[model samples]
Target chain A: MKITCSKSNLVKGVSIVSKAVPSKTTMPILECILIDATTDIIKLTANDMELGIMTEISGDIIDRGMIAIDAKIFSEIVRKLPDNEVTIETLDNLQTVITCEKAKFDIAGKPGDEFAYLPIIEKEDSIEISQFTLKEVIRQTIFSISDSESNKLMTGELFDISDNILKVVSLDGHRISIRKVPLKKSVADRKLVVPGKTLIEISKILSGEAENVVSISYTKNHIVFEFDNTIVVSRLIEGEYFRIDQMLSSDYETKVRINKKELLSCIDRATLLVKEGDKKPIIINIGDELMELKIKSQIGSMNEEIMITKEGKDLLIGFNPKFLIDALRVIDDEEVTIYLMNAKAPCFIKDDAESYVYLILPVNFNSAA
Target chain B: MKITCSKSNLVKGVSIVSKAVPSKTTMPILECILIDATTDIIKLTANDMELGIMTEISGDIIDRGMIAIDAKIFSEIVRKLPDNEVTIETLDNLQTVITCEKAKFDIAGKPGDEFAYLPIIEKEDSIEISQFTLKEVIRQTIFSISDSESNKLMTGELFDISDNILKVVSLDGHRISIRKVPLKKSVADRKLVVPGKTLIEISKILSGEAENVVSISYTKNHIVFEFDNTIVVSRLIEGEYFRIDQMLSSDYETKVRINKKELLSCIDRATLLVKEGDKKPIIINIGDELMELKIKSQIGSMNEEIMITKEGKDLLIGFNPKFLIDALRVIDDEEVTIYLMNAKAPCFIKDDAESYVYLILPVNFNSAA
Candidate 1:
C-alpha cells in the first residue's frame, strides 16, 4: 500500500482511532490498526473486541493494498512530523516505510486479514441528530453511571425514545440524572442500554465540532454513530434498567431557593474537613431567613451560612458533599430550588425553570441536628 | 492567641511555611505549625526534623501567646476564605477558631511546647543575592541532582562561594550541570551541601517577586536563606563532592553546531520508540553535513537526520535521549555547540557565551558501527 496525505489530516484521523486500540491483550493483532489504500482514499480502523472505530481521509494513493501496523507507534510518529506531506509505502516483505522530510521509519506490519471485522450499519434505519445536542445529553447524564460492572444494567445509561422526545437516564442507586431533548422527526420507539465508555468517546470527538448533525443506528446488541468521515460502534449491555422516576419523592415538606454559586462554594469549603472513610457528609440546616452548612471530621470542622428564601417548615438534611457539587455544576441557572421531604428521604434539586432534575439520596447522620 | 490579618497575606505566609510540614512521620508534632502572636506581628513556623520554615505577617494581635495547629487544615481554611480581613483566636481548650465573614472553622491544636525548635544563626557572615538570579541558578542545576539516597553525597548540590563569585554544581555520576553567578559584595570562602528539597521550595516562593533579595547564611551543619519576611533552614548533607571538572576531556575529535530547538525536537521524536526495561540509547552518526539519530525497540524503530555545520573527523556516539533533551532545554542561546572526544568518552555541550556547561556520559552499545 502506498499513499501520500497531509500531515495534519493524518494526525487527527490516526489519533481518533488510536483511542480504541487495546493496550494489553492476549491476542497480538488487537494492538494494530488496519490501513487500506484505494485509488483516492485511505481507511484506518482499530478495535478492542467491545468497541471499534473507523476513519477515512482523502489522499493521493499510488497503489492498492492493506497492512496493519502498531497503532501507538504510528500515532506518535505522525504527531511529531513536520508540517509537510507524509508518504507511507508497504514493501513486499510486509514492512511499511514512512517518510517525511529528512526522516524515515521502517515498521514491521502484519497482514490485514488477521484483524477482526467491524459491524456494518444499515442506512435505512438510521436517525439524524445534532452533535451538539447529543454531546450535551451525554455530559449531563454520563457522570451518574455506575463504575462497577457487576450490575451490567447500572453501568450503562438508558436511552429511550418515545413519540418525539429522546430521554437519557443514569443512576448509581444513590443519585440519578435525567435529561430530555425533543427530536426533529418521529421514528420508531426504541430503548437501548449504551455503555459509559462509548458515550465518553463520542463526547470527546463531538467536543471539537460545531452544530453538525450525527447519524445514529442500533440493532438488538450493537449501536453505531456516524459523523463527518468517522464511524464508532459498540456492543450494548443486556439487562433491565430501573425506573428512576418512581424512586423520586412525590411530595416535599420544605422548599428553599438559593444561589447556585454560593451553595457550591459553601459545599466546597466544608469538604476540606470531611474525612475519607468517615462518610463525607455535610449537614444543611434551613432556618426562617438563612441556611447553615456544617461538616465535622477527625481533623477539623467548618460551618458556612448563607441567606436564602425558605417556605413551609424548617428542616435539616445530610448528604455527600461531592454529589451536591456535581449536580450544581450541570444546572444552567444562577438560582436552584431544592425540594426535601424529610431527613431520610431523597432530595430533588432542579432549576426554577425546571430544565433538568437531579435526585440525591440523603445520608442518615446523627449530627444532622 | 488572637490576631487579625489580610486574607491574601495570611494565605501566602501559611503556604510558604506549610511546605516544611511532614506529611507522614513518627512524631505527630512535626505535622503542626507553631503560631506565635504578638502585639504587632504573627509568626508561623513548621519543621520536619530536617528542614524548617518561619514566616511572619503584620497583623493586629490582641494578646501574646503561642499554639500549634495542623498545617494542612490551616492552609486549606485560609485558601477558601473570602478576600477580606480574617480573625484567628485561640480558645482555652487549645482549639484554633478562624472566622472570615460568614465562614468559621475550629481546628484542633496541639501544645506549642511539643514542636521542634529551629536552629539559630549566630554569625554576621551573610551574602546578599537577588531573588531573580538565585531562582535561575537553582532551576538550571537542580534537575541533575541524584534522586537515589544510596549515594548521599550526590543527592545534594554543592554550593561554593569565594569573595564575590558564587558557583553551584550537581552531578548524578552519569550527567553534571554547573552554574556560576557574581555576587555584589566580597565574603569569606565557604562550601555547603544543600539538600535538593530545600532548593525547590526556595524557588517556588521566589517566583513572582522582582527586587527582593535573598540573604544566605551557612554554618558547619546547616544553611539558612532569609527573604521577604521568610526564613528557610536546612541541614547540610555531610560528604565530599566529586571533582567533576577532572572527568571532562580537554580535546575533541569531532565538533558540531546546530539550532537548539531543532535538535531537541529530533531527540524527542526518536525517544518515542525506546522500550521499557531496556537501556534507552539513541545512536548519533555525524557525516559531512548531517547528523542521523536512530532508536530500535521491540515495538518499532525511528530514524531522523538533521542538518548541522560540522568540522573535524566523523564520529558516532550513543547516549540517553532524555539527558540530551534536558541539556538542550537549559541553553539560553539559539545555537548550541557540542564537542565529542570519542564514542566512549563524555560529551560537552554548551552555548558560545560559556555561562553554563553540561557534561553527558555516553552509553556503551556493542551494536553500533
Candidate 2:
C-alpha cells in the first residue's frame, strides 16, 4: 500500500486501532494492523478476536493495495515522527517504508490475507446517540464492572434502552452503579452486554464532543459503535445480567444529606486506617445533629464527624470505603443523599437529583473483623 | 508528648522524616517516627539504620515527653488534617492521640527507647551552598549513578569540594556525568560519596525554596546536610570511585554543535526501534555537514539524519540512546557541543560554556548487530 498523509493525523488514527492489538497474541497475525490504501483514503484495522477497531484517514494514495504491519512498531514510529507530511509505501519482499523529513523506517510486513476478518455491522439496526452522553454513562458505570476473568458476564456493562431513555448498569457483586441518560429520539427497546474494555475504548474516542453522534449496532453475539471515521466492534457476553434494581434497599430507616467534598475527604482520611486484607470497612454512625465515620484496624483507628442534615431513626452501617469514594466521584452535585436500610442491608447513594444511583453491600463487620 | 502545631507545619516536618522510614523494615521500631516535645518545639526523627532524618517544628508544647508512632500513619493523618492548629499527645499504654478539627486518631505507638540512636555529626568542616545550585548539581549527575546493589560505591554520587568549587560526579560503567558550581565561600577540600537515596530525598525537600542555604558536614563514615531546621545524615560507602577524567580523551578528531532540542527529539525517535534486552545501541554517522542516527532491532529499523556544524573528518559512534537523552535533559542550553575522539572511543558532550560535562562509552555495534 502507498499513501501520503499528515503525520499527526496518521499517528492518531493508528493509535486508536493499535489499542485493540494484543501485546502478546498467540496468533502472530493478531499483533498486526491491516492497512489498505484506496484512491482517496487509507484504512487501518486491528483485532484480537474479542475486540476489533478500524479507522480511516484521508490521504493521497499513489497505488491501491493492502499490507499488514506490526501494530506496536508502526504506532511508535508514527508517534515520534515530526508534525509534517509523511509517506508510507510497501516495497518488494513485503517491506513497508515510512518516511517523514529526514527520518525513515523500513519494517517487515506480513500478508494482509493472514489477518482475521473483522465483523461488519449492517446499518439497518443502528441507533444514534450523542457521544457526550455515551461517554458520561460509561464513566459512571464502567468502574463498577468486575475485573475477574472467571465471571465473564460481570466483566461487561449492561446497556438497556427503552423508549427514549438509555440506562447503563455495572456491578462487581459487592457494589453496583447505574446511570441513565435521555436520548434525543425514540428507539426500539434493546439490551446488550458490552465488555468493559470496549466501553473504555469508546469513551476514549468520544473526546467529550456534545455535537458528535455515535451510532451503535448490535446483534445477539456482537456489538458495534461507530464514531468519527472510526468503528469498534466487540463480542458480547451471552448471559443475563444481574437485576441491580432489586439489590438496592426498598426502605431506608435513616437518610442524610451531606456536602460531597466534605464526605469524600472524610472517607479518604478513614481509608488510611483500613487495612488492605482486614475487610477495609468504614462504619458510619448516624446520631442527632451529627454523623460519625470510623475505621479501626490493627495499625490504628480514625474517627471523623461531619455535620449533616439527618432524619429518621439513628442508624449505623459499615461498607467498603473505596466503594463510597468511587460513587462520590461520579455523582455531579455539591450534596450527596445516602439512604440506609439497616446495618446489614445495602445502602443507596446518589445525588439529590437522582440521575445516578450507587448501591454497596454492607460487610458483616463483626464476623470479618 | 503534648504539642499544638499548625497543620501545614506538622505535615511538612512529618513528610521529610518519613522519607527515611522504610516501608518494610525488618525491625518494627524502625518503621515508626520518634516525636519529642519540648517547651517551645516538637522534634520528629525517623531512621532506617543507615539513613536518618531529624526535623523540628515550633509549636506550643503543653508538656515535655517523647513517643514513637507509625510514620506512614502519622503522615497520612497529618496530610488530611484541615489547615488549622492540630494537637497531638501521648496517652497511657503507649498510644498517641491526634486531634484536628472534628477528626481524631488513636494510633498505636511504640516505645521511643526501642528506636535506634542515629549518629550525630560533630565535624567542624562544613560548606555552605545555595539550595538551588546544590539541587541543580545533584540533578545533573544523579541520573548516571549505577542502580545495581553489587557495587555500593557506584550507587552514590561523589561530592568533591576544592578551592571554593564543588563538583558532583556519577558514573554507571557506560556513562559518566559531572557538574561543577563555584561556591561563594571557601571550604576545606574534601570528597565524600553520598548515596543516591539521600540526594533524592534532599531534592524533594529543596523543591520549593529558591535561595535557601544548605549547610553540609562530612566525617570519615557519614555525611550530614542541614537546611532550615532539618538535618539528614547518611552513611558513606567506603571505596574509590572510578577515575572518569582519565577515561576521557583529551583530543578530539571531530566536533559538532547542534540544537539540543532537535538532537533530543531525534534520539527519542531512534529509541523506538530499540527493544528491551536487545543491547539498545544507536549508530551515529557523522559527515562534514550531516549526521545520521540509525538503530536496527528485532522490532524494526529506523534511520534519522540531522544537519550540524562539524569540524575535522567524518566519524561514527554507537551508544545507548537513553544515556544521551539523560545528558540532554541536564543541559541548560539551546545548542550543545559533541566531541568525538574516534569511532570506538568515548564521546564527550557538554554545553558551549563548561558548566556540565557528560561522557558516554561507545558500544561495540559490530559484535552486537
Candidate 3:
C-alpha cells in the first residue's frame, strides 16, 4: 500500500485508535494497529478484544493494500515528523517505509489477515444525542463507577433511554450519581450497561461541540458510537444493574441551599487534618442560617463555618470528604440544594429541574468505637 | 508556643522545614517540626538523621513557649488558611490551637526537647558564592548522579574548591558531568562529597538571583548552607570520589562543530524507533561535511543526515541517545564542539572557556551479536 497524507491528519488518526490498543497480551498481534488503504480513504483500527476503535484519514492513495504495525512506534514517528506531508509505502515482505522530508523509517509489519474485525451491528434502533450533552453526562457520572473488579456490574454505567429522555447512572456501594438529559426526537425505550472504561475513552474522543451530534446503535451484547470521523464498538456487561431508583428519595427532614464554592473550600480545609489510610469522616452540622464542617483525627482537628439558607429541621451527618468534593467539583451551578432525611439516612443533592441527582451514604460515627 | 504571623509567612516557613521531615522512620519525633516562640522571631526546625533545615519567621510573640507538631498536618493547615493573621498557641498538655479568620485547628504536639538540634558549624572555614551560579552548576550536573544505592559515594557530587573556583562533578557508571564556576574571593581549599539529595533540596531553596549570595561552612562531618532566612545542614558522604580527572583527555582523532539544537532534535527522533529494554545505540558517522545518525533494531532501522563542520579525521561511533540528549539539553551554547578519539573511546564535549565538560562512554554494539 502507498499513500501520502498530512502529518497532522495521520497523528490525530493514530492517537484516536491507540486508545484501544492492548497494553500487554500474550497475543502479539493484538498490540498492532491495522492499516487498511484499499479505498479512497485510509482506515485505522485497533482492538483489545473487549473494545475496538476505528478512525479514518483523508490521503492520496497510490495503491490498494493493507498492513498492521506497532501502534506505539507509529504514533511516535508520525507525531515527531517535521514535514507537512508523509509518504507511507508497504512492501511485499511485510515491511513499511515511512518517509518525511530527508528522514526515512522502515518498521516491521504483520499481515492484516490474522487481525480480528470489529463486530457489525444493524442500525435498526439507533439514537441521536448532542455531543456536548453526552460528554457532560459522562463527566458527571463516570467518577462514581466502582474501580473494583470484584463486582463487574458496578464497573459499568447504566444507560436508560425512554420518551426522548436519556438517563445515565453510575453507582458504587457508597454513592450514586445520575444525569438526565433530553433528546431532540423521541425513540424506542432501551436499557444497557456499558463498561466504564469504554465510556471514559469515548468521552475523550468527543469534541463537545453543541452543534455536533452523535449516533449510537446497540445490540444485546455490543454497542457502537459513531461521531466525527471515528467509530467505537464495545462489549456490554451481561448483568442487571443495581436498582438505584428505590434508594433515591425526594422526601427530606432537612433542606439547605449553600454556595457551592464556599462549601467546597470549607470541606477541603477540614480534610487537611485527615491522614492517609485514616478512615476518619468530616462531620457537617446544619442549623438555622449556618452550617459547620468539622474533622477530628488522632493528630489534629479542624472546624469551619459558612452561612447558608436553611428551611427544615436541624441535622448532623458524617461523610467521607472526598465523596462530597468529587460531586461538588463537577457541579456548575452557583448554589446547590442538599436534602437530608436524618443523620442515619443517605443525603441527596439535586437540581430544581431534576436534571442531576447525587446520593451519598453517610459514614456512621458510632462504628468508630 | 504563642505567636501571631501572616498566613503567607507561616506557610513558607512550614513548607521549607517539611522537606527535611522523615517520611518513614522508626523515630516518630523526626517527623515533627519544632516551633520555638521564646524570642522576638519564631523559629521552625525539622531534622532527619542525615539532613536538617531551619527557618526563622518574624511574628508577634504572645507568650514564651515551645512545642513540636506533625510537619505534614501543620504544613497543610497553614497552606489552606485564609488570607489573614494566624494565631498559634501551645497548651500545657502539649496540645496546640491554630486560629485564622473563622477557622480553628487543634493539633497534637510533643515536647520541643525531644526534637533533634542542628549541629553548629564554625564560620572560620566558610566560602561565599553567588546563589545564581551555585544553582546553575547544580542543575547542570545533578542528573548524572548515580541513583543506585550499591555505590554510596557515586550517589553524591564532589565539591572541590581551590583558587577561588568551585567545581562540581557527578557521574554514574556510563558518563561524567562537571561544571566549574569562579567565586568572588578566595578561601581555604576544601573538598567534600555532598549527597545528591541534599543538593537537590538546597537548590530548590536558593533564590537564583544574581544579587543574592549564599554563605557555606563545613566541619569535619557536616556541611551547612545559609541563605536568606533559611539554614540547611547535611552530613557529607564519607568516601573518596572517583578519579575522573584522569579519564578526561584533550587527545582526539576527530573533532566536529555542530548546532546543538539540530543534533538534539535528530537524536530525539531516532529514539522513537527504540523500544523499552532494548539496548540499541544510535550510530553517528562523521564525514567531510555531513553527519549521518542511524539506529537499527529488531523492528526496523532509521537514518538521518545533517551538515556539520569537521576539523579532524572522519570517524564513526555509537552512543546512547539519552546520554547525549541530557548533556545537550543543559548547555546554553548554540554551537558545541565534540572531540572523539575512535569508535571504542569515550567522546568529550567542552565549551570554549572549558567551564563545563561532558564525557560519555560509547556502548559496545558488537556485544549485540
Q: Who is ahead in DockQ, 1 or 3?
A: 1
Give per-residue CA lDDT, model 3, range B1-369, as digits (tens).
688999999988998888799889899998899998867779999999799999999889989888998888788888888889999999889889999977999988999988898987765588888899889999999999999999999999999987888889999989999999887777888899999999998898788998898888888789899998999999999988898878989999899999998888888888887887778999998999999989988778988888999988998789998999999999999999999999889999998778999999998777542
Give me the candidate number with maximum TM-score. Answer: 1
What does the lDDT read for residue A268 in candidate 3? 85
Better of 1 and 2 by DockQ: 2
What local lDDT does model 2 show for residue B300?
Answer: 73
**Sort by DockQ, best first: what order?**
2, 1, 3
Q: TM-score of each candidate?
A: 0.95, 0.95, 0.94
Off by over 4 Å in 1: A208-210, A367-369, B208-210
lDDT per residue, candidate 3, A1-369, as tens digits?
999999999999999999899898888888999999877789999999899999999988999888899888888988988757999999989999999876889999999888877888766577888899889999999999999999999999999987888889999999999999887787899889999999999998899998899998898899899999999999999988888878988899999999998888878888887777788998898999889888888777888888999988998899999899989988999999999999889999999888999999999886632
Angstrom error of the Cα, residue B303, model 2: value is 1.6
Deviation in Å, model 3, residue B2 alpha carbon: 1.6
- Report the number of clashing residue pairs per model: 0, 0, 0
Report residue B130 deviation for candidate 2 (angstroms): 1.4
For each candidate, report its DockQ versus the true two-chain complex. Answer: 0.72, 0.76, 0.66
Residue-level lDDT tens digits of model 2 in B140-235: 899999999999989999988877888889998988898888888878888888899889888887744667899888899998888999988989
- lDDT per residue, candidate 1, B85-133, as tens digits? 9998889999889999899998888878788979886754778888988
Q: What is the Cα-based TM-score of model 2?
A: 0.95
